[model samples]
Target: MKRGEAAEDFPPLSPKACILSSRSGSRMNSTELGHRLIRHYPFASESLLNERGIGIYVPPSYYRDENKRYPVLYMHDGQGVFGPNPFSNSSWNVHRTAEELISEGLMEEIIIVGIDNYGQERLNEFAHPLQSSGIPGAPDIICKGESYERFLIEELKPTIDGLFRTLPDREHTALMGSSMGGLVTYNIGFRNPHIFSKLAVMSPYFVRLDLNTLREIPFYKRYPGVNNLALWLDIGEIEANILVEHVRGVVEELIEQGFVFGQNLMYYEVPALRIPRRIGQPECDRRCCFSSGSRAKQLKPSCTAEKKSD
Candidate 1:
């Protein structure tokens, strides 16, 4: 069996069982466990493309109340956002984290929408046309980020807002992802500031393209002010050396362009963990690192790190 294919056969595990297993020796009733499972819409079809659908994760409280409205965060790599799937070697477990945050009152109840990338077209769809230098044969790939963004803003958001009780303003909306997804979220958020006010980018794959001198992204020319937005950026200590340098360069550029610390933009760097060899195969590990960036945020200045074999 493939690494993530097992996710399909296994039913959603009860939160209580998971929690109880973690706790010393506590037992949880089935009814209590059922209540903890969030009301989620799996593979929700996009209005524009009926065949391609994104996963939706609503908080546990969403079903308990009808009048409550919540903030919405749109994330890329739908399969990796919540649990194991074809696209994820190790899931971020976002649902569990969000539930814990809500239970602890660290953050308000919010809705998470995970958008899946077109498997083969993922790289092309996520990259900006101007920045295509680092990617070999990048010209051969069709750049459709413009249309993809439109699908999110013009088609998907409207449908989601109409269906659920959401805080429809930009300030309450956030966009996030890791690797290429991170780069895309940054591109879209900066280009369409009126649509997204918060951005969470992790280990962004900015090296693949060279758009201008790196100092001037076309999006910056439109929205010069960064005060209106909140940004969270992070990277792992160990990854490909080139990719790490690329991420550092992007962060430095953002800082140079008026992204103040703790005010508008926040950056993090997490230490790398040594995984068992069985799960450390090249492709599987790539997704594992990307998924890990979503949950671990320990910011540090760029270090002189050695590169790992790809």
Candidate 2:
């Protein structure tokens, strides 16, 4: 096996064994009640940020087929993924959307892991001065994004791989998030291309930052072109004009660095998303194919805006 690749015939740990390894974690009900969502509460970390619960959504065929291994998508904002978000009463309905796509044979069956954000510390955990020019309603200073990165790459990924039957290679692994989470996904995806090959960055919080700030970001400084990485960048149609311009700027920058418009890079202006703050399930539905190794151009033209800009 390669550095990140998993053995095809490797056996998965029993659910009881998996739960026992994490002293602070508890296993919730599995496929017993037509529920495929698994919750591991207080998923303790070794030396990173505070421990938080994580939601893992196994595909419909996960439990039935013991020998099969699937790709994994690690998403931020776990609480709002499968269920309604407490803050806005809206959700991405990721599990529902994934099941639909898989049933229709639109994408491959994959595991979706939602990592919950630390409530008030979300900005501190997701935002970094090097990654952002400023975090609205918060001071523009250093943050613990590096620690957050270590938590995901070191603690979370390893734990998930050990517990689940996952195809843990870079090509099969992806990172996804919206807003601040989107910003960090973009940061982490490019910085560690060896770990993650796909990124779904919806409505990233680029704010009113200028190109100079974006150019100074560590990923841009280090990577001339992330052609090996697939990225999906988008914004709500009702969002502020500045945000649209910000995403456009980032798209242009990525293009300059060798990211093709309809190949590995995708930019969209989602008109169906009426609420600027809420992440739409349709967008999640569209991005499902990305995890299955589809190109960005395969997404619906109703949401894609690459031709207009080019």
Please provide, for model 2 over 1-310, each residue's C-alpha lDDT reduced to its tens digit, 9 standing for 90 to 100: 1224332332345664343244644544332112344554467655453667777777877767989999999989887877777888877777777777777777888998988888888877786545455433335445777788888998789878877889999989999988878888988888899999999988877664445555322211235656689888888777766666677777877888888877788777888564544755667767778756754334863223444555
TM-scores of the candidates are 0.68, 0.80
Stretches of model 2 off by over 4 angstroms after superposition: 1-35, 131-142, 208-225, 272-277, 295-298, 301-310
Poorest lDDT segment (10 consecutive residues) of candidate 1: 273-282
In TM-score terms, candidate 1 sits at: 0.68
RMSD of 2: 7.1
Candidate 1, 1-310: lDDT as tens digits: 2223322111243432221121233322221111233223322223224224356667766755878998888888776666565744676666656665556554567887777677787776777666445234355656667667877787668767766678878977888877778778888898888988888776776664344534322211123555466777666666655565666665566767787765566655555722211122222322222222232222322322222221
State residue 121's C-alpha deviation in candidate 1, in Å: 1.5
**What do the candidate models score in CA lDDT, each in turn?**
0.57, 0.71
